[model samples]
Target: MPKFAVVVCPHCKNAFIMEPGHKTVSCRSCNKRLEASRLKVFFASDDFKEAQAARGSVVAGISGDTAAFEEALPGIGRDVMERIGEDVQEQRYMEDKRKVNEKMDEEARKTKKKGQQAILRDTFEELAENGDIDIEEYWKKISFSGIDRLKFDKWVEKLVETGVAYSPRFGYLRKS
Candidate 1:
């Protein structure tokens, strides 16, 4: 299933919906880069309504506080009166999506990439032809260094998880 998140774009000072876990988001309004980690959480309409209704009570609670809070109120007021209003929260959700778009202007840019495990699995299929293959011999044939042996093991583990490859025995592999 697809997952989504609502976020406020600090670059454009606008609200936009986005998928979480992106390294960067291009602001639709300003076309500026927005680091997903720096994005602000957007409140839903219902939450906005509730906050609006409770704004008076929140001020009341703050005003009715002790002298220490009274001293802090000035700083809060400065932040509030800074000629802008925005609420930022840090929340992360996990999901995967791929976006392709065409527009009135130029063509869209996409940088899709294959994962390492998929590449290794493809190599297995091409070289071994689905037969039982010795792992060390295969790596030697490919001319990969000794350091890559551990990394290759990790890649094979990922391939096994995807149901595309399997370890039939110690130091041996076959397509699933």
Candidate 2:
């Protein structure tokens, strides 16, 4: 078996060399993600220099040079003019499963954000009492406010500075 393959991009018809074993490769010229097992291996060789020369020949052949193509065709040791069709079925199933998982993750994130916003809007100031507040409790009540812990701490500091609220202790707040 060859360590490297000279394959042509099915989308752009450009030739490039790649190592096998990976599930996919991005076409160098077209920037398209290609399943490596599905591409036609134009030439295969264990030597990188040999693969490069084969790629050059494939490029020349695509550029309308029939003589270069004919010369290169004879050098293909095995599976000449055949698709590298190993694991094609399994690859299709995995690709579909990956896309479905991504979509489910996105939907989960969106639903969680909306639920957090509703919780904050409903329960925020209800946790306060008698013009005094627990900073940690307030932060928990407003978790959907999209402010992280550091930002909440900075907000508390700003409130104290502006006389809107004051911190009498490290974790307590009072209205001014």
Model 1 clash pairs are none
lDDT of 2 by residue, 1-176 (tens): 78999887867778899999889999999899999999877667798877876777667556656566556545454354222222222333565698899999999999877775555434434654456688778887665566577766666687789886777777888776
Instruction: Output the number of the lDDT-best candidate.
Output: 2
lDDT, residue 67, candidate 2: 64
What's the count of clashing pairs in each model shown? 0, 0
Q: Give the TM-score of candidate 2.
A: 0.40
RMSD each, Å: 17.7, 10.4
My TM-score estimates for the predictions, one after another, are: 0.30, 0.40
| Model 1 lDDT tens row, 28-101 | 77888888777654322233333332232223232343343234334234443221122221111111111122
List candidate 1 segments past 4 Å from native: 1-119, 145-147
* Global lDDT scores for all candidate models: 0.50, 0.69
Give the Cα-based TM-score of candidate 1 against the true structure.
0.30
